[model samples]
Every structure is written in C-alpha cells, then in structure tokens.
Target: MNIIFEESPKEVADSATGFDLFQDRSIVAIKVNDELRDLSHKLSDGDTVIGVSIDSDEGLSILRHSAAHLMAQAVQEIFDPAKLGIGPPIKDGFYFDFDVEEPFKPEDLKKIEKRMKELVGKSQRFVRREVSDEEARELMKNEPYKLELIGLKSADVGEGAAEVGAGTLSVYENINPDGTIAWMDLCRGPHLPNSRTVGKSFSLLRSAAAYWRGNENNKQLQRIYGTAWPTQEQHDAHLERLEEAAKRDHRKLGVDLDLFSFPEEIGSGLAVFHPKGGVIRRVMEDYSRKRHEEAGYEFVYSPHITKSNLFEISGHLQWYSDGMFPPMKLDAEYADDGTLKRQGQDYYLKPMNCPFHILIFRSRQRSYRELPLRMFEFGSVYRYEKSGVLHGLTRVRGMTQDDAHLFVSNEQLESELTNVLDFVLGLLRDYGLNDFYLELSTRDPENPKFVGSDELWERATSTLESVASASGLQLVPDPGGAAFYGPKISVQARDAIGRTWQMSTIQLDLNLPERFDLEYVGSDGERHRPIMIHRALFGSIERFFGVLTEHYAGHFPPWLAPVQVVGVPIADEFGDYLQKFADELRSHGVRIEVDHSDNRMQKKIRDHTMAKVPFILLAGARDQEAGTVSFRYRDGSQENDISLADARIKILKAINDKTQV
Candidate 1:
C-alpha cells in the first residue's frame, strides 16, 4: 500500500504500524493527519504520517508526560493513600499533583526518583486503550480528583485538559514484561514506547503545595515537579542554569544589598524601596521623563482611586472585575429618623490608568493638529492578586506603571506604533537590556472575555504585527493572550542570565474610545472617533527595578549606582584630603562618600565593594603628595596614581556613558 510519509508517498506493507514504517529509535511518536499518536498506531492507505523526534518540542512534551506518569506510579506505590490529580508537562518540565495526608518532604523526592529509575530499568511498555466514560469512572473510582476530571471531559478544565478533553476517553497502561499491567493512568497521550526510552537524563526537582485546578476554593494538592531531557548533558546544563538563577534571585539580592523589603505588616506583595533603591528609581524615572518630553509626550497625573462608574463605562467592571479590588461604599446621606435619604456610590482603587486617560481625552475637543496627543504618567495602580500567585516584586499588588496613551487618527495608527516600539527599545537599551523580541498577543475568537468587534480586532492586530515585524526583531504569536479591549505587542527582553522578561507593551486599542465616546474634529470638519493606543515601557517601576536588580545581580552600572564613588583614606590623616576630592566630585552632582570610620582602609574598601559600589578612590600619603588617588573598580582592577583632575573626568565619563565599570 502507498501512504504519504513526511509529505511524500512511500510504499509500505499492509497493516504496518508507525514502528514498522519508521525504524529509527529516536522517532518516539508519529503525527497521523496532524494529530500526535503513539508509534504503535496502525497506518492506513493514503494516510499522512510524520515522525516526531524525541528532541523536538512536541517530542519533549511526550517524553516529559510519560516521565510524569512514571513518577505518579512510583508515588502511588510508595504512598498508598496518595490520590492523583492532573499531571501535565509544562515548559522544560512536568508536575503531578497528589492529594496526600501530609506534604512531601525533600526525602520523599529522593525516594520517588529512585523508584522511577528502577521502573525505567525494567523496560515496561506503555500501551494505550480507549474506553467509555462508564469504564473510565469504574477504573478511576477511587481517585476523586480523576473522577471530577472525567465529569469535566467536555469542558475546559485548565491544566486538567491534558487528562480529559472533548474526545474519546483513553488510558495508558504500564505493561510489565510479564504481560501484566504494572500501573495505569487516565490520559490523552502519545507517550514514549517504553519506560527505558524515558532515559536516565530525568530527575525529580522539588515539591510544593498547590491548589487543585489553581483555585483557592479547591482542595490543596502536593505537587512534585520534575524535569526530563533527551540527554544527560542537557539535563546538567539546565540544572546549572537554575543554580545561576538562584544566585541572581532579586529578593535575596534586595535584602543583601539593603535595597528593598516587603514588610509582612504592610502587605503580601507591596514592596518598600530603601534610600538606595529610591535613588535608582528616581534616576530611572527622571531619564524616562526627559525622553518622553523630547518625544512630544505631555505629562499627566490621575488619582489612585475613582468611582466604580468610571470602570463600568470603560468595560473593566464588566469584563475584568475579578482582577479589580472590591469597591468601597461612601457618600451616602441619611435622615434624622434613620430612613434612607440618599444612595451610596461605590469607589474602587484604580486597577488601570487607561480609563482615566480616556476621560482626559474626552474632556476637550481637538483638531487634527492634536490628533496624536500622547499623555504620559507614572500612574500607581492596585490589583487584587491572589496570595499564592504573588512573587517578590515581579507580581505585586500595587505598582507604578510608566504608562502613556496616544490618541491618533486612523492614518497615524501604524506610524505611531512604529515610533512607540522604537522608543521603547531605545529606552530599554539605555538601561542595559538590549536583546529583545516581540510577542503579539491577540484576542481569542472563542473566548467571550474579549470585547470589540471582529473587524476592529483584526485591524488592530494586523497593524501591530506590521509595526512589530518592521522593527526587524523576532515576532512570536501569543494567541488568546490579549487584553479584553484589544491586541498588544509586548517586548520580551532577555536578561544577563538569558531568562526572558516581558518589559514593555504597546497595545492598539480602538474599543476604549468607542466606549468612552471620544471624538476629535478632523480636517474634513467632522467629529470622528479617535483610536487609543496604550503603551507601558517598563510595565511597572517596581517590577522593572526587580528585574534590573537580578539582571545585574545587584552590581548596577556607574550611572545608576546609589553610591557611585566612595573615597577611602589609608589612615585617618588622609581622610581630609580624600574628603576634599569627594567634595569636588559632589559639586559635579556625583554620589561620592568618604569613609572616615575607625575601621582600616581595607575594611572600608571591602565593605563598599560588597555593597556593589562602582568605583573606590583610595588615597594615601604618596597619593596625597602627588594630588592623585588610585582607582579601584568593582572587578578589583586598579589604576594607580591618577591625577585628581583626570580622575574627575573619568568618573563623570563613566557615569554619563552608563558604563559597567
């Protein structure tokens, strides 16, 4: 029989399986008619089949999924009462949730990993079989979580979708060499052929408590995370990268450098910047303001809270109420007889600044001259983030967004977006983040949460895509990831450690102006609806600060360092000389400090270097006589006998150039 193989016709024997057609051991699975299936799947005449390499994205997912099943079987065997929840492969790893009486300790992971290795060595075959709903229920009767997932087979159950989808029910059996089922799981899988194929490159990472289905209202389940790779070298490389990431953790660096803190009494996700942190933030904002001013952006300010009606008019209350804080009732009046005389109004902390900017645009009538009016603000907004989801500074409840709204005509949409993208990239590069790619997040057609007509969405999405593509940066599609109002292009920046952070977003919004009834007098003498573009360069100041902190590992550049230059005297006598030099630099607006403490000069140098001071000026009797000081940099390199005048110029140049000295 002739069948299409990898887009080409090939002759194969009758009743041949993918295993028989593709004899390569690396081809773990096959795509039959665009659907992933196990290698054991039988082929039909004229069927199109393509091999799924074990190193490809889809192949890795299948390998990890099979690893997840192996780990689950090991867990159940080790812990008799553990009930299974969803086990899905995520980015670079996989996790399985279990309802256990006690949380898993570190030792538990070791045992599970050992059992998995033992199972892998046994070369058990993974056999898939389709069953009816009734049979699935009977097989998974003891697992209440699996039973619940079976009931939600026709619905979208988030991560549990990996287990049960709107299709025929199937289960994977780990068949031992003795022709008996060692274990079984309800899954929609195209897993590896056997346990040995999972390889020794897999490992159990750690365990954490996660709520089932990611809902606080649901029962908490103990989730064991693991990672699998096609080779041991790749697994070791991933572990090394993780170790480096831990060293660069912003929270730890923040505390160690005395930059910021999150006081428990204050809140869960609110961060308080110290004086040092404040210095960096002020410089960042000041530079941004200067750039915006040069770019024809007008500064604006809005209150932190507003009446709930504003959000209602903007469709935030209708579509994004879950993310907004609960409203506060106020301004109600009562009669002396305790009877209601006036109704109360509900006020809420503003979750976004776009609505306020839209109101400002509607406050006045303008002509084509002001059609591309750009309003900028460092607006503080509040969000009601669940406790479990909040991280150190990246995910916070309150943050200040470097937000701007551009009101442009239809003709100005593409150009304005192009300029915005350029401006965002340039500014981010100014802060030492140069590597970037663009992710276009478009609305999901099947989701009801997205507003706006299909025509408007397509126009906005296509225009943004054009702007992004024109910039020559790699553009990735993120379908179903847009905001409710419109599509947005987010700048994903890679930090020093190669981790991507979403730094800036340029959203082309046409629905907000329509909702707010915003208009501008065009050159044709008719009022026309203006298009609103939402742009946030840094996403949020607090989040950006954290990212920069991690990106540089607390060793900020000379321009952004809180204490740029510190003067150290060989003894207490030379303190006055170094102080005079520091005074001269201070006059040039340099953040210089002279250490005249009782500690030795070496101690002060060590202390300041530990604090990540960019430059250390060490003056001694010989240097004082020569009117010169030695330059000690953060990397411990030194320049001896630099004249005071020359040192001043070099220091200023480093600061002005934003060099990582």
Candidate 2:
C-alpha cells in the first residue's frame, strides 16, 4: 500500500503499524495525520506519519503521562479506595490528583514510588481501546471523577480535557507480561510503549491538596507531584536545578534578608517592603525614571479608583471585568423619609493603567506635531487574583506597573514600536537582564474575547511582526495570547540559572483609541484616530524585584544592593576607625554601615556576608596604624592593607559602573 511516511511517499504493508515503521527506540510514538497516536496504531493507505522522539517536548509529555498512569495504578493498588482525577504533564513534570480517604503523607509517596518501580520492572504494555460514551460511563461507574469527566465530554473540563474531550472516549489498558489487563484509565493518550520504557528516571517529589479540575468550589483532592525524564542523567540534572531553585527562592530570601513581607492582616497577595527592600525599590525606580525621561516619556499620575464608566468606554469593563475587583457603589443621597434616592455609580479599583493614560491623552486635542506623545507612570493597580493562585511578589494582587502609553499616527506605528522595543531592551539590560527573545502574541480568531476588525488586527499583528523581525532576535509565536484589544510583543528573558521569565510587553492597540473616541489632527487638517501602544518595561516593580532577587540569588550588584557596604573592626579599639571610614563612604552617597554590636569580629563578618553585602570593610590596630583597611567580599575573598583612598575609589567605581563584586 502507498503511504506518506515522515513527509515522503513510500510503500508499506497494508497491515503495517507505527511501531513497525519506526525502528528507533527513542521514537516512542507517531503522529498520524497530525494527530498523536500510539506506535501500535495501524496505518491506512495514503496516511501521513511522523515519529515523535522521546526527548522532544511532545515525547516527554507522553512519557510523563504514561508515568502518571503508572503512578495512578500504583496508588490504587496501595490505597485501595483512591479515586483518580486528572493527570496531566506540566512544564517539567506531571501531577495526578486522587480522592483518597486521607491526605497522602511522605511515607505514602515512598510506598507509591516502590510500587511504580515494581510495575516498571514487570514490563507491562500500554494498550489503547476506543469506547462509546455509555461504555465509558459503565467502565468508570465506580470512579466518580471519571464518570464526571465523561459527562463533561462535550463541555469545557479544563485540565480534564487530557482525559475526556469532545471526541470519542478511549481507555488505556495496562496489560501484564502474562497478557492479562492489570490496570486501566480513561484517557486520550499517545503513551509510551511499555512500563519498562518509563525507566527508573521518574520520581515523586511531593503531594498537596488540589481542587478537582482546579476549581476552588470543587471537592479538594490530594495531588502528588512528580518529575520524569527519558534518561537518568537528565532526571538528575533536573533535580539539581530544582535544588538550586529552592535555594534561590525569593520568598525565602525575602525573610532571611528582611526585605519584604505579606502580612496576613493586610490580606493575601499584598506585600509590604521593609526599609532595606524600599531602598532597593527606590534606586530601581529612580534609575528607571531617569531613563524614561531621557526617552521623552512624560510622567503622569492617576487615582487608584475610577468610575466604572471610564473602563466601559475603554472596553476593559466588558472584557476584563473578571480580573477587576468588585466595584463600590458611591455618591448616593437618600431622603430622611427613606423613600427615593439618587442613583449611585460603581467605582472600580483600576486593574490597569492604560485607560487612565488614554483619558490623559483625550484631555486635550492634539495635532500631528505631538503624534508620538509618550506617557509613563509607576502606576499601582489592583487585580482580584484568586486565592489559590496568590503567590509571592511574582503573583500579587497589588503591584506598581512601569506602564507607558504612546499615541502615534498610523503612519508612525511601526517606527514607534521599533523605538519602544529598543528602549525596553536597553533599560532591561541596564538592570542586568541581557538575554532575551521576543514573542508575538496574536489574536485567536475563533475566540470572541478579542476586539477589533480582522483588517485592523492583521495590520497591527503584521506591523509588530515586522518590527520584531527587524530587531534580529528569535521571535516565537504565541497564538491566542493577545489582550482583548490588541496584539503584543512580549520580551522573554532568561535568568542566571537559565529559567525564562516574561519581562516586558509592547502592545500595539488600535481598538482602544477607537473605543474611547481618541483622535488627533493630521497634516491634512482632518481628525484621525491615533494608534495607541501599551508598554510595560518592568511588568511590575514587585515582580521584577522578585525576579532580580532570584536571578542574583540575593547577591545584588553593588549599585542595587540594599546595604552596599558594612564595616567590621577586629577589636573595640578599632571600632571608631572603621566607623570613620564608613562615614566617609556614606558622604559619597554610598549605603554604608558599621557593626557596633557586642558580637565578635568573625561573627560580624559572617553575618554581613550572609546578608549578601557587596563589600565588608575590616579594620585592625595594625591596619589602622598603616592607614589602610581590609576588604572582604561576599565570596569570602579578602584583600588586606589597601589604602583608604584606593578603597574608596574602588567602591565608588563598582557602584558607578553597576558592576557585580
């Protein structure tokens, strides 16, 4: 029979399967007609097929999904009555949810892992079988969550889509070496060929409480998180990275360095910076302000709350109301008779700063001369983030966005976008994030949430694409990731440990201006709608702060360090001498401190080093007599007998150059 295999037409046996076509062991599954299918799937004439390598992203997901099924089987074997929920492969790992009689303990995870290893050793084959909806319901009658997923086959089941979607239901039977079905699950999968291929590279990390399908209103199930890799070496490397990531966790560093806190009394997702963190924030903001001013951005301010009518005009109320906090009804006046009262208006805490900037632009008529007017604000906006998703500074309810809005004529949109991209990259580089690529977030035509006509969206998307392409950076397409009103180019930055974070977003907006009736006079003396561009360089101060903290692992550069220098004396007699030197450094705008506590000099050095102080100055009677101080760095390297004049020059130069010491 004739078929297209890996994009080339070839002749194969009529009964050929994907497993028979791809001999490489690494090719775990096959994509038949663009749909992922098991290697055992029989090929039909004229069918197109491609192999999926075990190390590829799709292959890893399939491997992890198979591992998840293994884990679920193990769980059911040990914890008899454990009902299964969704098990999907995430970025670097997989998690399975279970409705168990009790929460899973660490010991339970160990037992589960042991059983999974035994199952892997048994070399069970994964066999897929298609079933009708009623048949699936009957098979999963004892499994309440599975039955629910079957019922939700035609609806949006969120993560449960991995199990049962709006298609034919299928069950994967884990068959033993003796050709008997050992365990099974209702899943739409392209899983690994056998349990042995899952190998010993998988691990169960931890377990926690999770809602079924991630809905807070649903019953909470126990979720066991795990990681799986094709090879042991890769698995080991991932575990090491996880350990390093834990050590660099910003939330922990926040407490250890006394930088910030999320006080429960103030509620979740709101952070209060300590004095040291405030100092760092101030320096960050000050430098950003200087850069914005140099880039011809006008600083503006707006109230925290605005009437709902403003957002309604900007289309935010209609499209983004879910993210917005509930409005406050205000300004109603009632009669003493408690009869009729004036109608009150709803005032919402601003979820974004663009609409306010739009109002600023609309406050006065403009001409072509002011075409590329830029407005910037360190605007504090509030979002009603769900409690389940509320994390540290990275995911907060209240944040200060380094937001900028540019109003330019349609002819200047591409140039302005290019300039904005350059400015964003340069500013982010100044803050120590140099590695970046651009992601183009275009509208999903099928999604009704996006505004604007097809012509406008195409123009804006193509314009932004041209600008991004001109920058000569790798551009990735994020289909359906755009805001409701516009398409955007988001800068993805890789940190020290090679983790990517979305740093800045430059959005080209055509709908908002039209919605708000914003217009400017052109050279032809006709009123023309100006295209609005939304840009956030830092995304948010709190989020960037957290990113920087983790990127540096709390060892901030000398310029951005909270306490740049600390002085330690070998003995009490030398205390005044070190203090005198600190005073001299402080006069030059350095953040310097002298340790005057009763602790030993070694303890002081250790304490300041742990605090990530860039420079620790030490003075002894001998050094004092020599008119020199000892230099101690965070890495515990030391240089003794450096003259005070030379030391001051070196310290000042590091801070001025923004160099890491």
Candidate 3:
C-alpha cells in the first residue's frame, strides 16, 4: 500500500512500489478528479491527480491562505504581539486574527499591507520539515493557541485512527537564497513554492473583532480580511463588482426612495414600510394572489405564535433553538406542578410554516384520491437573527415567506417535484428572471446531525435527482448542504445585472413525516408514509422585493408598479380632463393618480418618472380640445396627441402582459 505524504522527501510504507514524485513544488491543491481533498491524503496507481496552481479558484484559496500567513508574519514582525489566532481562507478572501494593543486603524492596515507586499517581492522560499508531537509542542512554546491546536491534532491522530499510521507533522519556514530563514509557521502544508506565487492579485479588505475561535465567551481578537484573485484583471473586476454592489445596496436605496425605515426605537431587522412601500407591497401581493388562484392554489392562514409542544414534535426546538425567539415563560400555577395539568401551555413565535401545514394535512385522514395535496400560504415567520448579522430586508428577523408544502405519495414524488420546479421556474420568469441554476443538496453519510435512516435519505435524494434530471435542469450537488430533516433542490436566479440570488427551494422530506407521524392510506389499503415536499418559490417576500427593486433599479413592471399611471394637466383648466382620464384608467383596476397638488405639469411628469410610474398621461387644453391626451413613458418616450382611449388600451395591454415600460 502506498502511503501519501505532503512535501515529504521520501515515502515510507509497509510495501512500496515505484515512487512518482511531483516535479513542481508550486502545487497549491491536489485533487483526485472531481473530489477535492487535503494534500496529505494517500494516492495509488490510476489516480488522476490534478495539480492546482495560483490561477484556479482553489489555487487562489491556497494563495489567500498563504497570504493570511504572510499577514500573520507581518503583524508579528511589527508588533511584539500577545497571542495568535486561527487564519483561514474564506469565499474570495482570507482573514487572520491577533490580540493586539488596540483595534487596528486604516493607516495601520496600509502599513501591514505594504509589509505583506514587500515580503511577497522578497520571494521567500517555503521549506517543509517534519517533527514529533513533543518536539512540535516545544517549538510552539510561545503560542498558547498553537499549543491547543497541537493537543487537538494529537487527539485527531490518536487511538483507532493510528491504524492508518501517523504521518509526519511538519512546519514550513520561509527562507532566503542566502540560507537565512526569513520566518516560519507551524503547518501541515503543501504550500506554493515561494511567496511570489501568491501573485499581486491580493488586497486587504477590512478589520473586525471576532472571538478567538468564533466562541463568544472567548477573548476577542482583531481580524484582518483580505481578498485574492488569480489575475489582475479578475481582481479589478471583482473590486468593480463590489463597488457596484455597494451602490445597489437596498438599505441606501430604501432610504433615498423613502420606501422603508427601521427606527432605533423599533429595533433592528424589523422595517416599517412607508406608504409608497405599502402600496408597492399591496400591488405585488394582489398580483401573486391572482396568479396563484388562477393556477388552482388555495390560500390558508395559521397563527403567528404556537405552543412549545407543537415545535417539540416537529424537532425544531431541539435542533434550531438558537435561531428562535426565546420561549415565553408560564406562571407557577400554569406550569406543571405534580398535579394533573392541562398540556400545551408554552408559546413560541413560528420560525417556519411547514409544521403548521403538516398539522393541517394530518387534521383529516387522507387517502389515495388526494394523492398530491398542495397547500400554499404567504406565511410570516419570526427568526431572532443576531443584530450584527442583520442587513436590510434581505436578512431580516421577521419576513413573510411565499411558502407551500406538497403531500404526495411515494409513487407521485418525481412528477410532483417536477411540476413544483416548473411552477417555481415559471414564477421567476414572470418576474423577468430567466437565467437560473439548480442545486441538489444531499445529506452527508458521515454527519450524524441529520435525522432519519440512510434508506429514507437515499430514497428522498434519489427522487429529487430523478425529478431534476427529468426536468433537464443543469444541476450541481452540494454535499452536507441538506436541511437537518431532508434533501432539497434549490433554484438560484440571475437578474438583469448578472447577480444571482437564491429564490426558490423544493425540499423532499421523510424525517418530518416520521417525526410528525404523517401518513396516507394507499391503494393497497395500508397506511404508508407520504413524501413531504416543502417548497418556497419566493424564499421571502421582503427579500425578493428588495432584490426586484435593485434588479429593475426600482422601475417596476406595469402590472407590479405601485402607480401604473399618473395624470398631468398643463394648467388648472385641464384638471377635469386629467381627472376624467385617470378615472377611466382606474376603472380597469389600474393604479392611477391625478396630479392636483399644484405641481407644474413638468414637475408632475418628473415626479412620476422618479417614482418609476410606467406611464404618464399629460392633458392640456389643446389635447382636450382635440379629444386626446399626451402619453409619455418613464424612458422618455412620448406619444403626443394620442387619443385617451388608445392610450388607456396600450397601458392596459402592458399591464395585462406584465411588461416593463
């Protein structure tokens, strides 16, 4: 058997064959075909090993990881620091933590970044050396955190795991060509050959205070964040995207538009919609209700707060208590005190609508006739999100979900899932989002946090995969991304600006059914478990509204516009004509307004345009005499002297077709 070792000069094994050594030391990531594994994993013949460089995404991660090391090294060089903390690679970036004299300032960041660049230019070589655990502890004497890491490493390599043979634990020293070592880090690395390989595609982002290892009770350390890319162009493009993202920030837009606000007295993550915002929300919900009704869906409602026992049976209380609002306490008399007491006394604000929907389904004994029961609700849920993590409507503590659950037989699972996916895709398309991708989130066999048996998980996951395949969806699999109860198919939609947002999800759950004891009588006359498919086309109404606002730049489509049309009169003499025209449009269920606030025609037109009203109907004595009204659109297109009826027809058609004007 061949035993793999990272950066080892020679391979030691029970029985060895011809050893094939990698030629280049710049291999940042070593993967076996599609699977990414740590570089220390063993390899055998016929293994297709792909070497990652500084140009690939994985390569950038490795570079960023090394850059984090460089940051740590630089901080150590400048400040005779107190304690070290963990530094790891994150999405598009890396971060390192340190206990310092005070919070790091912007100027200090500039100096640290400059020092990092200098170290990169020096092209320090990384040399790996193996040492025993006792020796490692002795070497890392100054770092108490390192000593703790050493202990964890010892535990990981202890007992039954030792049968795999204890591989050499090593540290890498950054050395100069003159044979003097620049600096070193205790690591188990297959790092890039030199500091220069980290490339110029790196930048220090920001600093934040974090617990030493993410535990709140632990001492806080200042974390410095940085981003790395494969090339200068990619880096610049990313930075530009970040700038655009900042400009498109919904919080800023919400304030500027006066759509929503969160007062300090009102608390965080709970926004109060302004009149304009309420108007917009009303229009959106009305449209959704109309469409859903047309599609044969029945709306239902449930209480915002439920008893603690309801969630206890649903397994949410045990697993998701951290994200939930603290349970309301009961008075001593209300509490169970040895004497026989009525149950179901504790209360909780609902975090999800699935359990309530399931309860609705279980309310009656179901049969084969109602094989695929689809129930929908625009249900509002409250999740106590940490204040630090809350950001605008997208990440809110309280929001309404366009949620639904399908109770289908095992035989109907595939077709039902397909239909749900198609419906979700169609809904997103109606909202002008055509580009989308699908992800199949499956359970990790090694992870015990997930509920249900392996057989049930396999069946649920396989059914979802089949449905996705049949739907011809280009699917990607995300292991360990499944919900605690079951697997799911998530839909990610890309907007006009090429920004992707997770909008829809279709999850197949067997665990919840088992937990809730949900079943249906099958054709064979035996009670069988009904596969529960939890779906939410629009993850959250508030979040989707925020996304749509940014997607269209607040220029909503005619059907969804808070005000579809605004009537403008050149002078008070044409006020009657303007009101008459607005009334005609409003009669057809259109949101039309007549400008009678003494604002000029020009100012009215500008106001309507700024508010993103689709069409502006301008009336003047000349147009009124000719039996016409001047029609203009937000995009500055004018249809001068158009008949009022003709203008109304065009606007009605646009609204009916749900077209952006």
Against the true structure, candidate 2 reaches a TM-score of 0.86
Name the weakest run of 10 consecutive residues (lDDT summed) in model 1. 153-162
**Clash pairs (backbone) in predicted model 2:** none
Looking at model 3, how many pairs of residues clash?
0
* CA lDDT, candidate 3, residue 302: 92
C-alpha TM-scores of all predictions: 0.87, 0.86, 0.78
**What stretches of model 3 exceed 4 Å from their correct place?**
1-69, 82-90, 117-180, 186-202, 211-220, 228-237, 264-266, 327-344, 567-579, 594-606, 616-646
Ranked by TM-score, the better of candidates 1 and 3 is 1
Write the residue-wise lDDT of candidate 1 on 462-540 in tens digits: 9999999999999999999998878999999999988899999998786788888888999899998889999999999
Task: List model 2 lDDT by residue over 87-205, tens digit each.
Answer: 98987889999999999999999999999999999999999999998999988999999998888884777765779756799999999999999999999997899999899898999
Regions of model 2 farther than 4 Å from truth? 1-59, 80-86, 98-107, 127-172, 186-193, 208-222, 230-236, 341-346
TM-score of 1: 0.87
Ten-residue stretch with the least lDDT total in model 2: 153-162
